[model samples]
Target: MTGLIKKYIVYTAVLIGLLVFLHAIGALRPAEQYLSRGLNPLLATIYSWGTNINVAFDEQTGKADLWQQINDLQAETNQLISKNAELKAVEEENAILREYLNFFNDHSYEHILSRVISRGDITNVIGRTESILIDKGSTDGLRIGLAVVDEQGIVVGKVAAVKEASSLVRLVNNQQCKLAAGILGSEATNGITEGELGLTIKMNFIFQEVEIKKDDIVITSGLEETIPRGLVIGKVSDVNKENNELWQSAHLIPLMNTNNLLIVSIIKP
Candidate 1:
């Protein structure tokens, strides 16, 4: 193979030398048409190959960048949506406060707004007594036995104990609790409502002769020194008189939902 390559090299050199000698003697002609045809094709192929590689790389980079941008935009959109929802909730709470304020002003009810600071969690078996704590206490004119009420003048609880700046309230739904309530639209007939659970209170001890109906508002009679007069206790939901001898039975729905209470008032007097 080496010998054959050497022979070919010698022949090619002699041919090139002969061509140069012919050209020098004015016997050789320039093949311009052949040069243009053969070299142009080779150069065009190389250029086209290089252009294809460049375009493919550029397109890949653009696609990667577009995907990254889309991910970033999605993250930003999610953050904005969460923030909007939080703001809307805050606005709704403020609207509720404004409504209560207007009603208090309009009725000229002696009142003060107290924010809820702590609450009883039923899951916490240690304090299943169903009580709530507020920020107001003896220092803020709250007493040990003061009646705690919601914005709508509905009794929520009575202050059980007071500290300098906080107080514990026994909720109206405490099973051991009892209050004197007057049946509205029934000519001042009063009954005793006792806490069945932390959910509802039952107004019992009505005389067998008294008439009771559903949807009747029950208010505190203020007969005792514990709760004030005219504070809302609940409204009757159902009434059943199974026999003429049995005392009329009724179900009372508390005016306040303890789960949603945020602000309340402690009746000082």
Candidate 2:
């Protein structure tokens, strides 16, 4: 037991002596300072990396906000374009109404204004005449054989069949349509102006001795009861004369175009 005690004491004394020698040489202070300095540089580098990461995150957030604003502006631009198109359509319709007003004020005939609803022929006693349907009918005091004039007061057609709310008009360019017409030049030469091929007018049955020239204005000769006098029909394009035949002819182009019939006034009987 004594021997064991003596060895334990000897080991303890050596350990104490070694620790005292290390403390007395000033090595402990330098080592402590060295550890602190090395740790400081490592800590500072870690902090700098963390700061850069935070700054990059903030920049990414700002870009996301700016991108959203651009999308919102693009959506607003499309809505404005649709509104502009509707306004332009209204302006065009108003201009057409003004033209109708001017034509009504200048004429003296007992008339009723009507719009062309369709452009197709109806059943007629004179066979099929290329015709248009008007919106006015017997309820509006319209009847069969009423003369239809255009917005320029030029004869375009005559009402052929009348319904309660609509009427069919035989256009002047129809082959079945015949008007008592005359060439108003130095002296009036009256004849029947007939439609040819649904495209032209031909004033036939004129006397060969009559003096007719190109560009002469042809007007109604007032020979028909429903139609009146001085109503312009067409312009003379050329004269066809045959010495043997008693009848002379003149080719005329109608003053009114039936292809774009929009509005017309029926001359009431």
TM-score to true structure, per model: 0.53, 0.55
Quality of model 2 by C-alpha lDDT: 0.68
lDDT of 2 by residue, 89-122 (tens): 2343346668776533223568899877665644
Task: Please tell me which predicted candidate would have the highest TM-score against the true structure.
Answer: 2
lDDT at residue 77 of model 1 (Cα atoms): 45
In terms of TM-score, how similar is model 2 to the real structure? 0.55
As a whole number from 0 to 100, the lDDT of residue 8 in candidate 2 is 90
* Residue 143 lDDT (model 2): 82
Question: How would you encode candidate 1's per-residue C-alpha lDDT over 1-269 as one tens digit per residue?
Answer: 99999999999999999988886775643353244334544544554465456545655776967855764684464344323433443454457769777533222345556766556557733423467767665556777777777755677877788755567788888765567777643325378777775677888877777777887667766665756556667778888676755677778877665654667788765
